[model samples]
Target: MMDAALQALKQYFGYDRFRTGQDQIISRILNGQDTVGIMPTGGGKSLCYQIPALLFPGVTLVISPLISLMKDQVDALKDVGIQATFINSSLTFSETNERLSAAAQGIYKLVYIAPERLEVSGFVRILEHMHVSLVAIDEAHCISQWGHDFRPSYRAIPAMIDRFARRPAVVALTATATPRVTTDIRKLFGIEAEGVVATGFARDNLNFQVVRGQSADVFLLDYLRKNRDQPGIVYAATRKEVDRLYARLTQQGLAVGRYHAGLSEKERAASQEQFLYDDLTVLVATNAFGMGINKSNVRFVIHYNMPRNIEAYYQEAGRAGRDGEKSDCILLFAPQDIRLQKFFIDQSDMDETLKQAEYHKLEQMIGYCHTETCLQAYILRYFGERNPSGCGHCGNCLDTREKTDVTVNAQKVLSCVKRLRERYGKIMVAKVLAGASEQKLRSLHLDRLPTYGIMKEQTQKQIGEFIDFLTAEQYLVQQGGAYPVLALAERSLPVLKGEARVLKKGHIRAERLAVDDALFEVLKQVRKTLAQKEFVPPYIIFSDQSLREMSARLPATDHDFLMIKGVGQQKLEKYGHAFMQAIAGYQAEQKNAVN
Candidate 1:
């Protein structure tokens, strides 16, 4: 069975071997055991069920959550010569029935359906008649309320499975799952702890970064200009910001699109389609976008504001470098973004318990922005990894700016927060420290405080930023929601007593990732042309990683082309001649030019 799975993998998906957890997950599923797979965003989770689906005698049912995800996965499957289809709201009733009939006839080896479809008795009746061999649940974290993105509809899954006369093996998969959520999923699935297969949450190809105290627009424009040809996403916290950034980038004549809940469904679909098709080089969107997006060539994911938590941030950032190529994950943070996030938490419908949980997560995210330690290590520790080492490529690890000792400055700020009786926000604290003669300060008699004017040499903005830095480093705590007041933490006591020191690095600039070579560009154009001809995304035909390999190897024969990664027998048979001809033509051009 494992050998057959391996053959199916190379024959269709073009991979020579399984990724980290894929083999183990597939082995368990084939052996008829309920399994749970926890992998990073780009860790090839889809292949875990896909390989098994091909090897199984009966059809595989894939319970997906999103329409776009269902369509994308089905389309990719069909392109690779697999018989697959999706039943979702996008299809007409008759079209859905037609597909269901076909599924009943055992035509499709895999059928992707929305979780809601399982609720309809008619739909379940039809599925019951089919010889369902396995059930694969994607984004399984949605079933757990502890997960960041919880859906009550996922709760119906187990009951529906029990309705099956012959309970098929089950496998639940998710990209982001904390230990708490993992336990919830295991309990819901009735799978033992040993049944879980976690490949760890780490993307070596992604470079994590947090850019603070910089003009976000200026930094984004500069980064875009530097990597103008690369594909990327700019995520904002709200639809309004997405619109504003989209307009700005569009006005600059960049190939960009926008997606948010505020847009009509048609508008959102069009934008997503354009982005997936590579017609647009950049997408400006809110957190509502990029779930289950399988685009492999995204080179960067920049957050215009701080996300609500690290889980959301990591999943959004993981959208980049899915093709196992180098990519950047940048967060442009400001003090106001924290307030905005807090406001969101305050306005949410969550109960007090959940709200407090959200606040704690937000503080951890803030700590990530402020931490002087390795950025990737900070995230790993947050997700329950034990003593993770620093990733040398992340922003913090690559930072070469000289560190400046600011213990005295920190002590002054902590002392001011203490003097203010912890009743004021950071702005007021900064004003007092800068000796601003504002009427509010005078009316409150804050200017007369001993700590006032102690840091008067620095501007108010500098003082406020320092306070933000202190807050992020845990020296000071921001209490209350929407209108948080600065309070000293236990960590601040040592600083106030002059027992510990605070050091901050100078500003670091974003650098452009590597550029494509001439041959790679020529092949990319070929891919684009082919994609247009087929009316599919360019990456579906061949990923940039595959194109790079083609350029580097300059394969002259079918055998050599097959040796390149992502080139399976099916893709080789379908696309081999055109790509090989392009490579051959380029090589001939070089020879002729030399002659």
Candidate 2:
């Protein structure tokens, strides 16, 4: 059975190996176990059910939330010569019935449906008649109210499964699920702990970065100008920001598009198509843009503001480098971003408890932005996965450092808090230390204290940075209340007594790589020509990774081309000759030039 599954993987998807947790999940499902797969974004979770669908005796019913994802997956599957179809609100009533009738007759091997369809009486009646062999739920975290994106529609899944004449093995999959959300999913599906397979969240190919104290507009313009031709997504927090960024980028004459809920359905679809088809090099969007998008070549995902929580940020940022190539995930953060997120929490319809949970998650996200530790390690730890620190590729680890011993500065700050009775927030503390002439300071007599103005050499921004760092490192803790106050922790005793040292790194920027423009251009031409001939997305034929590999390897024959990662038996048979011919021609041209 395992061998058959492997055969299906190679034959259909063109992959020679299973990613970390895919094989076990596939094996467990084939062995007749109902499972929950908690893999990271880009971890190949779809293959868990996809491969089994090929082996199952009847059809696989896939419940997905997004219409775009359904169309994208169905197209990709059909491109690989797999029989698949989708039934969604986009179809006319007659069209839906036609597809449902075909599915009942086993004309399609896999059927994709929106979760809302499961609640429809007519759709449920049709599903009961279909010979369903498997029920695979994508974005399974939507079922958990504790999750960042919860949908009440997902609650209808288990009941829908019960209506099936022959109960199929259930596999629930999600890219983002906290421990609490994971338990909820398991309990909802009645799956035991051993039946759950969570392959940990870590994307080594992504370079995570957080830059503060810079104008986001200026920084974004500079960065985009440098990598003008590469594919990227700039995520803003609101539709207004999306529109603003879109207008600015468009004014600069870049191939960019904008997506938000505000756009009409036709406009949103057109914008998405433009990006997916490589007509747009950049997409400026709110969180609404990326849920089920499978565009594989996005080289960067920049957050114009911090998201409300780590789960949302990680999922959004993980969209980059889905093809397992080097990509950038940058967050341009400002303190006001937190205020904006807090405003969202205040306006949300969630209950008080859920709102409190969101606030706690927000604080963790703020600590991540300010922490001096390795960025990757911080994210992995947040997801309950422990790994060794100092992943050498993150912004902090790759930064050229001049570590200043801030032990004395930390002691001064902690002592000032004590002298002031720990009644103030960070700004107040900085004001007292920077010796500001504010009336509040004078009225409170804080200006008369000996500790005041001791660190006047430091700028207000510098003081705030140090304070945020101290709070993150636990030398200073923030008390919880309507107006939280900064209080010294037990660890501060060591720093105050000169027993512990604190270090701060002055980070120098790293150099960017110069792309192989000539070869990259040639490959794009070939991909465009091929995509035009086939009328499919270019990445579907050969991902950006495949093209990059081809350019680097200069494969001159069919055999050599097959060795590339995404090239499989099916793809090799269909498109190998053309790519190999292009590579051979390019190599010959280079040789002639050298001669």
Estimated TM-score for each candidate: 0.90, 0.84
- For every model shown, the clashing-pair count is 0, 0
Show where candidate 1 strays beyond 4 Å: 405-502
20-117, model 2: which lDDT tens digit per residue? 99999999999889999988877888889999999998899999999988988998888888899998989999999899888888889999999998
- Give candidate 1's TM-score: 0.90
Give the candidate number with the greatest TM-score: 1
- What C-alpha lDDT, on a 0 to 100 scale, does residue 379 get in candidate 1? 91
lDDT, candidate 1, 208-320, per-residue tens: 98887555787899899888899999999888999899999989989999999999999998999999988899999998899857898999999999999999999999999
Find the candidate with the highest lDDT and give its number: 1
Error of 2 at 469 (Å): 12
lDDT of each: 0.89, 0.87
